[model samples]
Target: MHQALLVPEVLLEIFAYLSIISYTQTTSTQKLLAALARTCKIFHEPAMYLLWTEIHGLEPLLGCVTRLHPLIYHSGTWWDDSDEPWTKGVEPLSAHEAHQFLRHSSRIRTLNIKSEHPHLLSVIPAEACVFPRLKSLSLSTTYLNLFLPHMLHRCHLLSVDEGLQSFVTRCIALEHLCIYTPHDVHGTANELISDRIHWCTRVVTLSCPILD
Candidate 1:
């Protein structure tokens, strides 16, 4: 049975089935994929790739870096530099760790960040956190300004707020865009969309309601 499962075509089919099941069932997918990865050396790469493709939040991704036991900085007496430090919680990823994190992060194709935590966005350095394969992004209005620019260069689909007109111009490969214009800003949505129509050459689907 083990020898039969080692065939390349059979392994690909098995991995594909696991990917479909993982997408359809969100709650248990992570655990199941992690377990599958540990089952055998052959299953590890594909299972891990699927596990990191569609990340829902920053915690798990950050967990990977933290688990590597990277160095952490702490606040100390300004005058003495040698005084006992007192800062708590994990510090930002060191330069080396940031590089390692980015290597793994490059596999992510879809990222959905719904949490409102301000610090969550700071965990990874903006300049170093480029997701080369990221195609889909869902961000709250608050985080749009902070994270959009760093990711827009590669993202194909985006869900963001109306205030993104300035940033949308930078999305070269954006194919689908959904902007949630608030009531106060209803009148400007159309104008903004019209003015920026040529910003993203590949945009085929836009969902910004024009308020009358």
Candidate 2:
């Protein structure tokens, strides 16, 4: 092995570059990191850290809880209908499973959930802050109630209202928020959001949908 590769900083920079390049390639960055993670113990932590730094969906995080394996497999098709039977008969995570879930969840810095998956609500650990190091989040309205308790620095929201209020009051670290409402916001809803925004001075950047 090369001497420079022995240095953690050098390895991280090299891996970081690989992550950027993979964005334009057919191969994903996570695949490359996953390979490095399995290569040796020295490469494992950094590789896994970068791999879990930013995640597109909750499945990868939820997969850590061994009890949820069966539930996650159905997630690909589960987003279509909230009333689906798949959400039924589900079990909550055991204390040990919740600890396992937190181990990986703590690594996620950015999380984006495109659609709502109700099963997560039933399976998520009751921890107050699942993603302790999370800095950015992108979520559908369906997820607002599920994830609002976690603090974040930046957020992108698909729907708005009480969810918006939760973010304002609970996410004291929040500096940026972008909201896109599928339907135009009107009446008291507009005033309520505006008032909340006025009270939360920590937010430096905010983009809200056109008010009616």
Best by TM-score: 2
lDDT, candidate 2, 1-212, per-residue tens: 88998898888888999867887899878779999999998899889888899888766766776777667665444333344544456666566776776677777888988644555455563335667788898987566655654468898877666656676557877889887765656887777777777766788998887533
lDDT of each: 0.57, 0.72
Error of 1 at 183 (Å): 2.3
| Candidate topping lDDT | 2
Model 2 misplacement above 4 A: 20-27, 70-89, 123-127, 141-151
Minimum summed lDDT over a 10-residue window in model 2 is located at 78-87
Q: Can you give the TM-score per candidate against the true fold?
A: 0.63, 0.78
Instruction: Report the CA-based lDDT of candidate 1 relative to the real structure.
Output: 0.57
Score candidate 1 by TM-score against the native.
0.63
Summarize candidate 1's per-residue lDDT along 1-212 as a digit string, tens digits.
58967775676567667656767787466678789889988887777787788877554555456543232221311211233422235354566655555656776888776544444346555433366667777766555544454335333223334645645444566767765555555445557656665566776776665422
Q: Backbone clashes in each candidate structure, one number apiece?
A: 0, 0
Cα lDDT for residue 187, model 2? 81
Please state the error at residue 28 of candidate 1 in Å.
2.5
